[model samples]
Target: MQVKDGLTFQEVNAACGVKIVAPDLEKSIAGTTLHLANTKEQIENAETAIREEWRAIYEKMPIMCSVCKEISPRVEFIANCQKGNPCQVQ
Candidate 1:
């Protein structure tokens, strides 16, 4: 496999035959000691995009009751109406 920058030691171990002992230390001293196998900027951008997408979805629909497993309507749920109907179980 191709070894790039920013890849975790565990990931590199899985991809390659080499086993990493100290992943934390290696990541901390990346570029100086251990070379990364992936781009940190790419990973951060992907994480940001995923977070933004999830935030949008959460804003659209939030407050799912664990007991009833029901999601309340946006307005009623936001208003904290105790009389709100339970959502249909999947």
Candidate 2:
């Protein structure tokens, strides 16, 4: 769950956790709002909300188009068929 600097890891073992040098790891984890997951559905419910929020954020994010090499908003890219280009290309 630690997302920093494009770094990716599947899982962290408790024994190896002691050897790692992340100063803020403990503080961050401690500060996180914890919810009691009494059932499988509860975990999925929380994760679903979190995923939706991130999806909305990514939708508004702007990026350069690969074909035209021009900046384009993600929403515009998603239009697919609709007109009125925001990037201003004719």
Candidate 3:
């Protein structure tokens, strides 16, 4: 499958005629020193999206706790909880 970095790990595997495990999108192939693969376009796109998302969150006001009246610093917001940890209330 193609990674966010625009490099097709599948294609690289096909070309090398080797099968490897890549748990994360940006991991090295098993028994290989080279990283999965990446393209300029993919890297740029990834960077742009990251910057945009960061900007959006950074520009927002601090979240105040309703119970404690404590203000929390702006933090990265995740739409998907796939990474396990979501935004903490602390």
Candidate 4:
């Protein structure tokens, strides 16, 4: 198989880039089995929970002006701009 950069085995397999190989034997042997402990639904639920937690934290945080280093809600900053008073960065 060809070596590719920055790709997981699952990604390559999904892209049909991987080839499964086995040895030729005279007698039959038992095949390997994989048991997935976490189902797809469990993984999705975990990701959703993480995103909700982060969103809750982000909502409480104040926004900082890139020009003046002022920390406040974004709406207040926009109001200042609307009043013809822009941030002055020294």
Residue 46's lDDT within candidate 3 is: 67
Superposed by TM-score, candidate 1 places the C-alpha of residue 81 at a distance from the truth, in angstroms, of 5.6
lDDT of 2 at 48: 81
Candidate 1: segments with Cα more than 4 A from true spot: 1-37, 62-76, 79-90
- Which candidate wins on TM-score? 2
Better of 1 and 3 by lDDT: 1
lDDT of each: 0.55, 0.59, 0.50, 0.57
Better by lDDT, candidate 2 or 1: 2
TM-score of each: 0.32, 0.40, 0.30, 0.33
* lDDT (tens digit, per residue) of candidate 1 on 1-90: 755544343434343555455546643422222333368886677667666765566566657777676676565565555565344446
Q: What is candidate 1's CA lDDT for residue 45?
A: 74
The predicted structure with the larger lDDT, 2 or 4, is 2
Name the weakest run of 10 consecutive residues (lDDT summed) in model 4: 28-37
What are the clash counts of all predictions, listed in order?
Answer: 9, 0, 0, 0
lDDT of 2 by residue, 1-90 (tens): 764445345554444443344546564333233333558999898778656766777787887866567776688876842664434444
Q: List residue ranges in candidate 2 displaced over 4 A.
A: 1-38, 66-70, 80-87
Better of 2 and 3 by lDDT: 2
Whose lDDT is greatest here?
Answer: 2
User: lDDT score of model 2?
Assistant: 0.59
- Model 3: per-residue Cα lDDT over 1-90, one tens digit each: 654433334435344544444567363223323332389887777667666665665656476545555565545223212465444446
Order the numbered candidates by TM-score, best leading: 2, 4, 1, 3
- Residue-level lDDT of model 4, residues 1-90, one tens digit each, is 655454335434252554444455333223322222278887687667656765665554577877788887656667777988657667
